[model samples]
Target chain A: MILTNIESVPGLRTVEHMGLVSGSTVRSKHVGRDLMAGLKNIFGGELKGYTELLNEAREEAIARMVKQAEALGANAVVNVRFSTSAVAAGAAELYAYGTAVRVE
Target chain B: MADIIVFIVLVACGYFIGGHRERSHYRSIFAREAATLELTLLSGKAIDPAWQVAQAALVTGVCVISVDYFKSVAAGLRNLVGGRVSAYESLIDRARREALLRMKAQAAALGGKVVVINVRLETSSISGMKADGRSGQVASVEVIAYGTALALA
Candidate 1:
């Protein structure tokens, strides 16, 4: 699927605007991973475990968005935006939203 | 006596792991940056008129970094005295740069030359109030680097 954050695609013209489609997911690491990350925290470096967790969550969110766009019979998602928030200690929410549109 | 021992250990751990990892990450960033010198990355909203965007896609990279136990302790002390927490400065810096590198890597993998416009960075702290019935402490933060990738038509 073609997704762009700009108002319009450069080559193709937007034919229809399908309002807004969004996807959200909340995720946290397991206890084993958290413990390992906490130990690394003492050394102050990249927490690979948490990084992988959030990365997966983001991809999943985007996938859901793509599914929504497909359901709307849209060829692309435009003006896409992403947001992340802490839902609770150790839990985070990633949200992706955009305008689904048909470009021709 | 025990407190002194713990203090020394924390500093030792920070120097051994955090310091080493930071130095290596910097070196890697600079090296990879030179390799990707031809690509463009900008924060402006306008795309170049000379180029026609054949395909546009959104790419993202994420990095989560944690403050070492020693640094957090130092930060707490600095909070009392009202000065810069020098330890965390590099931690955040590393996170931002690493996140950007990952974004660039994604752009390259997609056979794209540059990140056209609308670059955004989001940062959030997510290591607190453990969901697993363990200690809830805020030591790690998540950084996301996102932008649009445009391929030449």
Candidate 2:
């Protein structure tokens, strides 16, 4: 399913607006690696943990959004957007949402 | 000395029990419910009653869970000599409003007049008890808003 935060997909036209769709998941990873990277910033090093955590959250949220679209019987989801919140000290809520629509 | 120790234990117990109860209450409130409404662009299609029923159930489930948790916590702390429960209220309000706003925006962007039927709300926590003495408390509530938009002929 195609998902973009943009209000309209660049090329595809929305034939039918099938309504709203969304998926979300709460997740967390040890911040130790992030802290280490920050410390290493004295010399400079990649913050692999933070990057990985964000990527995982984004993928999971997107996957869930796709499932919602499928349930709505839409072939694709347009105008997808992603959002995140630190729900707790160690955990984050990642969400992806979009308009489920049929396109030609 | 004994009285002092007893008071300390009681306070600890209050914190432990209070926190545990809060977490479970929020979890129950955040349980997931989904609904779907089908709208046919052509005439002569009947509205799906199942969708309406599902929507009612979802809304009730979420509202009840939220209100119950808030009431219980507030009552629990009422008798205690504490300054304020403002922090908890703020947390709940922020999470709930943010979730609702996100859902509403998504619905509008999809060209649906309003989100009707099959709204899903899920809640989870980030902490787990460990050997290093960390307490598990509710970190966040995730409200998943979903519904079907129909266009009639």
Candidate 3:
């Protein structure tokens, strides 16, 4: 489905507004990954493992959002936005939300 | 004696990993940025038709970065000196760039053109393993890059 963070798609016109569709997931790193990340921290750069972890969570969240949009018969999700919160010390939650619409 | 040894190990490890790794990462980011310069990545909010967007989708990328024991200690020291803790600079820089690149990759993967607009970069600090709440240092950070991927319609 087409997704954009803008209120309206430039060339396309909106035919139907299917309301809000949102998806969220909470995730935490494993001890093994944490230790590896800690080790990587000593020489600061990218924490690939944690990055991947969050990315995975984000993608899953997006998938859920898309499913909701599909259920609403939306061909696109517009004005999509992302938010993150610390669920716990080691746990994080990623949320994706947007307005589902049919555009042509 | 053991304490001194531990300190030396921490510092040495940081030097090798943090210092060397950051330099190499900078080189890689710089190269990739130059190569991708032709691609449009904007921080604007408007949906500009100049993009000739035939199809569009939301694309996102995320990165997490942290400091080693050595840089944390250095940061603590810099706190006392009341100056910039250069230790954390590269951490944020790398996270931001990496997040943006990932977003771009996602956009390109979906048949979207290299142009991605209305990009938003958000950052947050995640608490580390030390949940005791005593050390309050932000041991890690998460950078999120989100944008609209406008491809030729």
Best by TM-score: 1
Query: Please, what are the lDDT tens digits per residue for candidate 3 over residues A1-104?
Result: 88889897768899999999999998877777767766666667677777777778778888999999999889988888888776665566888899999999
- Best first by DockQ, ranked: 1, 3, 2
Interface RMSD of each: 2.4, 16.1, 2.8
TM-score (C-alpha) between model 2 and the true structure: 0.38
Q: Candidate 2's residue-wise lDDT over B1-153, tens digit each?
A: 999886565545434644555565445334421121222111122345433211110111111011123333453576386676663464455345434444444444444333333333444223221224243332222333333333111
Q: For model 3, how does the per-residue alpha-carbon lDDT over B11-104 read when each residue is reduced to its tens digit?
A: 8888777778778878988887887776688888766546566767688888887777677888788888787778777777788998898888
Ranked by lDDT, top first: 1, 3, 2
List per-candidate RMSD values in Å. Answer: 3.1, 14.1, 2.7
Tell me each candidate's TM-score: 0.92, 0.38, 0.89
C-alpha lDDT of residue A93 in model 1: 85
RMSD of 3: 2.7
Q: Which stretch of 10 consecutive residues in model 2 chain B shows the poorest summed lDDT?
A: B56-65
User: Model 1 scores what on Cα lDDT?
Assistant: 0.81
Task: Spell out the clash pairs found in candidate 2.
Answer: A4-A80, A5-A80, A87-B139, B35-B118
Candidate 3's TM-score reads: 0.89
Any runs in candidate 3 off by more than 4 Å, and if so which? B110-113, B124-138
lDDT of 2: 0.45
